[model samples]
Target: MRLRHLLSASTVMLGVIVNTTAFAAAPDVVRIGVAQQGTGDPPVFGGSPAATAQLQHRVEDSLKTDGTKVEWIFFKGAGPAVNEALANKQIDFAYQGDLPSVLGRANGLKTHLLLASNVRAGVYLAVPPDSDIKGVKDLRGKRVGIFRGTNLQLVADNVLKEHGLSERDLRVINLDSAASQAALASKGVDAVFLDYNLFKLQRQGLAKIVYASRDGGLQFTRQAHLLVLEDFERAHPEIVQKVVTSVVQASQWSSDEANRDALFALWSKSGVPAQSWQAEYANQQLKDRSSPLIDPFLIARYQAVADDALRLNLIRQPVSVNGWFEPKYLDEALRTLKLQSYWPRFDASGKPIAC
Candidate 1:
């Protein structure tokens, strides 16, 4: 099938009309949902109340002109609960990992991508610090930790394939990030796929990366994005535009060094440790400013995800990139805010120019 047909259809032009109507009947309040990894820290990045406050502040500021009020609804549960809220239309929007986004879309949820956050280049295939394993090919016949149906798992598969190995060649163990990290530290698994933030573990000399995914173009390149239900978008188009605008503004603000203190402060108060907040904050900013601008390249990456998911039997049908994204609202928001100057310059053909 053609790529266009495989992805969601373009609804950019219709988005404006739908959004306008939604704004006209603006509800007294809008409820936004959030998801986060709950196992490790006090205030999770997107799930904790502290992160909620910061988001509320930003969204309120953006929607003030539209006479909209904001309320936050956080889900302490993991992936399944988040999906339930979205399916039930209990919330307006959500910020979640890439794999969940794909799963939600495949399940017929009306979700949209708002922005990318924290494109860490450090996801690795790690073994106990003392392990003799040296590369992806070394994992054959060994137990490997992975969270199935996730970006990490997909990347793990890609990396092994590149090394002439397959999942069938290893004993695959299913575990979440937190669990996988612990299993690696205890030497319970021969090798585990993990994010760079596990540097804390590496500092203790408990683990060492057998293969660095970033350098090999095999890293998950995970993106946390904001998504809203289709009915919500249809009901409150103007509000959705405001939400998108707020996200763009927040992303831009997050890129500034002076803003780092305030960002960390918010994160720290939300239950994240000061040190961890600092690390994640810096990583998110670096990604926001320097990562590949969202365009055809990203669309292709999403397609790759769809293809891989199908091969793994994770999802039943192929998904197209076009129908999944509606960039018109973003463009509209940028133009209305006259914040075009804040965005990187692109040619008439929509190619980004080097600064």
Candidate 2:
């Protein structure tokens, strides 16, 4: 009887040990996908903490001691291709734009919005120098190139509607960023709706900037974010916390006014000239753009993106912003880092507010 009783206790101990081992198992690698690739051989990106984190190796540095490797996969196809990777479970996390992420959610991709990577990023409209087109309204009945399925498409639509025009009023061509630049330079397209890269073309006298979203105010700007797979988050909350914390640290550095020049220099690796970044960010505060908070303003912008996405038939169904954001990790990171008040909070109207 004594021997039998001892054997039973040992069996229970062995079961507990197996369960604990399974529970604590961590993946050997963490795969991160970036929607946009940079110009280098092993590309780098800019304009977000995810980019900063990658350039600085913050995330990898945090996990290196644990024997976990970080793999960053950049997509030349941008946000739409990132959605496909997410769908196939080929990536554990992604840095993507608002529209593509919403479309992914509507199509049943289970992920959590970690935090805003970049916000209030303006778009531009450029036409060939000496062209007859002078403004947004002039694009009516003219061939205009846009990178469809990107955050730019929705912003372009909104800007057109503001000018009493829609995409239907123009001959719209779906071109990627590089193709759009080439087409605009060759006058293959009458005008191109693009980002700061257009400034480079203007410098070369290849294109004329007719309109910029900065003049239209913050509502016309676009947003991007960092998101993690739902399954990955559930399985490794500790690793998720570390990743979020590391990104928050990078954000803190990127937001400082003292680091402005250094920040621009670091981001210029993406093939965009530093002067272009300086011009684009010229009246903007770094903290306002580089904020890692998932505040009310961020939520409102995403919800508006979802609404517009549906109204524009970009998505088959409505996507909910609620429960889509997982803020506890961000909250904990801010708290532990003693940076709860480091970044300013904004209201839904994009005005600064106390929280």
Candidate 3:
């Protein structure tokens, strides 16, 4: 009888130990890597659903009860640099663009796509103030600056292709945003492909805006997403769910059309002017750009990006978009928050589909 009692106690203690071990699996710190830097000294970014989460402290608030610290590490080198940090295990989650993320996956980084953080960001073509280059065709034989290895590169190359030009036809210089802007200011490069940030150069009288992607249509834009290192997600899925939930909450808030002014106000902390954000999103519905759903449109776009990368020799091996996404967390969050139909779904061609 005493032996049986002792065994019962031992079993209870073993169960307690196992439960404690499970609880302890949650890390004390969660590091998230951001692909680009914010404008100011303290460094905050805006313009995406993930950015909205950061701005609103959604993730931090979600994890705080567990005594977990959330750290947002921004990389000025953009997605490529974020990929390096992911390889080093310095970060568990990342907000990165399509190409660099695909490149990382092709190179053997294990991560699962969690959510579509942002999409359909337009591209811009800017030239020196006095240059006569008026269109993409005129870029042939000219010194063009592009941030190579970024999502920008593939689209820029395609834009060139559409105009009967190629990277081979131009003196292509690999430059990041700041360097490209400086090169344009110094007239070191004849033209630079940029995003909405190009407006800053035009406002400063440093560059001329020749082409805006919005003028061409939706196909001209690029996409980005929130992802988690597979190891981390496998180890602490609860924490991953919390993070995804917070981002979805932020996306919901950001997608509300009534919060337009308030949303820009929050984003302007990144040192971009409120007017710039306003102009960037002008005549556009907030819900379309801020949706967190990994719908058919997003999947198709990523697959297309992967194909383009392989065909352009941008990635050595084919990065399959299939099984790359883990959407259960997102789906669960939408269900839990009752936001299943909050954001509209889009088809592969960017057209809205009924729920």
- What are the per-model numbers of colliding residue pairs? 8, 0, 0
Candidate 1 residue lDDT tens string, 1-355: 5776545344655777787765678777787666645323332353222243344487888777767777666554545467888898787787665666777788888877754443333357889989999998889999999876555777788788889998999999987777888999999999898664455577778888667666674234554556677777876777887777777666666555676666656555554445655543443443333232355545555667777778877789877656777676777766776765564643423345666
The digit string of per-residue lDDT tens for model 3 on 1-355 reads 9999999999999999998798667798999999997666657899898999998889999998889999899998999999999999999999989989999999999999999987888788999889999999999899999999888887888788778888999999999988998999999999999877777778889889999776776666789999999989988999999999999999999999899999989998987777778878988888889999999999999998898889888888877899999999999999999999888899998889986
The candidate that wins on TM-score is: 2
Can you list the residue pairs that collide in candidate 1? 6-320, 7-320, 7-321, 8-323, 9-323, 19-237, 43-270, 43-271
lDDT for every model? 0.65, 0.91, 0.90
Ranking by TM-score: 2, 3, 1
What TM-score would you give candidate 1 relative to the actual structure?
0.76
- TM-score result, candidate 2: 0.95
Error of 3 at 73 (Å): 0.4
Candidate that beats the other on TM-score, 1 or 2, i.e. the better one: 2
**lDDT-better candidate, 1 vs 3:** 3
Per-residue lDDT over 29-62 for candidate 2, one digit per residue giving the tens place of the 0 to 100 score? 9999998866687778887778889889999999
Candidate 3 runs further than 4 Å off:
1-24
* Candidate 2 vs 3: which has more TM-score: 2
TM-score of each: 0.76, 0.95, 0.94
